[model samples]
Target: MINILKGMKDRHSDDVKKYDFIMDTAKKIFSKYNFEKIITPILEETELFRRSVGDETDVVSKEMYDFIDKGGRSVTMRPEGTAGVVRAYLEAGFHKADPIVKWYYNGPMYRYEAPQKGRYREFHQVGTEVFGIRNPYLDAEIIKMGCDFLEELGIKDLTVELNSLGNVESRKRYINDLKDFMAQRFDKLSEDSKRRYEKNPLRALDSKDKGDQEQFKDAPKLYDYLDEESREYFEEMKKYLEIMGISYKENPKLVRGLDYYSDTVFEIKSDKLGAQSTVLAGGRYDRLLEIMGKVKIPGIGFAAGMERIAMLMDDSLIKEEKKGVYIIYFNETKEYFIKIADIMRQNNIKINFDYNPKSFNAQIKKANKINVEYVIILGEEEKDENIVTLKNFITGEQKKYSVDEVVNIIK
Candidate 1:
């Protein structure tokens, strides 16, 4: 027998309920921010990530699932959401038609990597992006929206770590100094950090290696290298964040694991998330569009790992949907019960009936297993009279009621 694939999960019962709660709460908050929903294809050209996410990044270099399709087109299951959204924006002529747009997406992202606890090969994310807007207030607003989204989900103890990546020139200067510093102890760096040192030295700061992190202690801080314009931009973003009551701390080494990010970058970390503590993270990608298609469009956005958020969410906080009604019937009245169950369903009631007519006690045992609020009894007597006995699971009270009465009472 074939078993379920590794790193894949089937969400059912409470798991599905929790997933629904997360998405519903996301829609509620995203709509409040006036961010329209955009659904992009799960599959896109593999070149999209190579261009936008960067060739040296782990997401592109190590984890992306790309292949030549049946049609001989190189395609990939998206490893992240932002790149696809940008592709959609350009392809739909939104660049010329609607230059500025606030859009959010909910979808699954695939990565070919070892899965653990909150991290999965196939994970879901709810993210938002604002295009063609570079205002500092909007930066703070986006971070606040992330905080509000988590707060709405009852996941607390969040730390907002803010930083600046500077522009192309400022970053180039910092990268040169960083590469020189890391080269002195190249052998001590982790294999991943060593690979990143030459092509993308900034990612070394985000390294999890103990030795790499130790080497960073005396390294040049990215904040110190920010040019005048980038410095002012970071300061303005901090000021607005303070005014908006979103407490944050500066992390000079908070360069994210992507090649496109520039200017202000921030991550909202939660203590409860263990080592993988960042519950949500995003940064300004002022040069990404320029890099992708040579069209300048400044954008900032954040993506929350739905699985990670669910990991931090309190079980009680995610309200489980209450079970409705279960119908039990005898063998002789199977057809009668199905029609009655259909009638109940048509009346906007959630009803489930035993398909194979079972003993009265046996059916009630099944109903009890489901923990339904009520059960409809359709034995020979009830079937003959065109009436049924409704037993309230909670109250343990039984009463005879007509089909219409049953609908009204359940409704």
Candidate 2:
């Protein structure tokens, strides 16, 4: 037999059902916040990601699945959601559509990372983006929306880690100070951290390497270097969060792994996910639109991995048991069964037809397997009498009814 790809797995029916449930629930919650749905192509120009996600980041430098297409154009499978959204926003002139445009999207993202628990090379994300507004209250609402989503999934023990990377000037000063700090401990740094230190030193703070983490222990905090304007912005964001009763912890080391992010950055962590604990994360990227499209539109958004959210989901939170009718018919009664099935369907009643010409016992067992509430049995005798037998699997009651009566009962 041919083998499946190392990083991809075929999802079974149950897994697909769970994925649908998660997507549906997320859409409902996002709709309540007035976010319209938008979907972008999975394949995009490779430069879009390199320019937007940043060439210095791992997503662009290491994880991106990029190749030259037949047209000799550099194309890539998107590794994240925000870049594509911004591209669409600029292409469609959405900046002129509304002063504040809010949109949500859910789809597969491709990356070439080593697959681990709750992480994959091909993963799905449900994300939201708000453009044109830089209000702190909107930031607080976005954070609350994330919390609301996790709560709806019944995920427990979530911690919100918040931080401010400050403005460009403050961040630049902090990065220089951090580089000087890391320079002394350079010999103790990991190989990957060393490369990051040379290219994007701020990203070294986000390193998972044990030795590099220790080296960053004495690094200067970005908050301390924040100028008065940036400090006030961070304080105002926290004030809005407090007003909304959203609790968060300040993590000085929480500079998100993206270069576009500025001011507020946050990660919603769940203890249940172990080492890959961040379930949802994003922050303000006020200059991303300007950098990408030469159009200034401040934006803030977050993306949550569907796989990670599904891992922490409680089965009880998703009601998967569907109530419906199953039809069990013998060969001779096929015509009558089909007619009844049509009538039930037209009435908006859920019906499952068992077309096999098997024994009554075998057919009824199949019906039980599906756990349907009602099973309609049609045999030669019932067909001749223009009636059908209805069995209430829940109550173990059996009765004969006219075709109209059966339709009414099923309805």
Candidate 3:
């Protein structure tokens, strides 16, 4: 049972260090871009996902870990952070905050899906949302934030793919056009794409079906369907990326599989992870708030999957801190050793003394096993003299210091 739990552990100490570094660096970057931090609960009312993520989307249809709580009200572990943040925006009345509020969140999100490399049932994401703003600059700013984050992690050869889903009327026309295109190729589509034909025909563009692949070669591109305003917004976004020297590919079929997205959509891909490689993705969802009961607020944002980023991160960038102090006592003076260990702890020193009352050799091995730096030796002579022997087990160096001096040095 212990071994099983160990294998399934997601946030080990080393993993925690990586997570902290990513979040801390991301928060600093987000703040520089005029974004605040907003943390939402791990769980929320079940209806929130259905409305915000759309009931037909994969997040709602399959991935969500929704269940009825003890109160008999259905609740779900959040599959993504944006919905909860949006809910909080309305619930906490942040709607009145100057018409443009930028916020970021980092935490674990639950999805009931099979685990894969860099993709887990329980995963972590760093997300940023710019609420109450529809400016194309805001969209470019958010995309740039994700771009800078990946670049900071030492990832290279990344390309951002851009698209626009357009406004309601334009989208209606495109969907009909796409639906007709898919109808001719229905017999050739994969079972999954065939199922999607009636619901979301746009998803067919991303079909993996060999038969459907050939059909999409001449499928109507969204660029043709973009209205003047949407086309203008996309052009401005491209100009900003050009000004920033951010190279991107325009993927006409890069429609995010969600209902709320409109006008602008994008994804950043890293060549490191082949096929299932979207390091980050998001777009403008101008109609999300209206659908979720908040009026007249359109937002744009994106989220980066932390697990995937961490996987591609260079291990040399960070060396995990493992220099902990261990208290080792032999024979007599247990009380003195305990008191001294307590003092070390009070001074913010990570001191570990096994309370199992084991032999000296066994305790030393345990200390080494746990990767502690200095093993503090307390014996009759040292205890009597109000001093202690600090041993650098790694280098086999021993030094004597008065308890006061030791306290100061450790502090």
lDDT of each: 0.87, 0.87, 0.83
Total clashing residue pairs per candidate? 0, 0, 0
Q: Model 1: how far is 20 from its true place, Å?
A: 1.4
Q: How large an RMSD does model 3 have?
A: 2.8
Model 1 residue 18 CA deviation in Å: 1.8
lDDT, candidate 2, 1-411, per-residue tens: 999887877787767877888888888888899999998999999999988988888888889999999999999999999999999999989887775899999999999999987688999999999999988888889999998888888887778899998888888888888888888888898888788777888878988888777878878999999999889888998998898888889989898656678899999998875664899998999989989998888999999999888888886777766668988898888888888788888888898866566898988888899899999888899889988899999999999999789878776
Which portions of model 2 miss their true places by more than 4 Å?
274-276
TM-score of each: 0.94, 0.96, 0.90
| Candidate 2 global Cα RMSD | 1.7
Error of 2 at 96 (Å): 3.0
Better of 2 and 3 by lDDT: 2
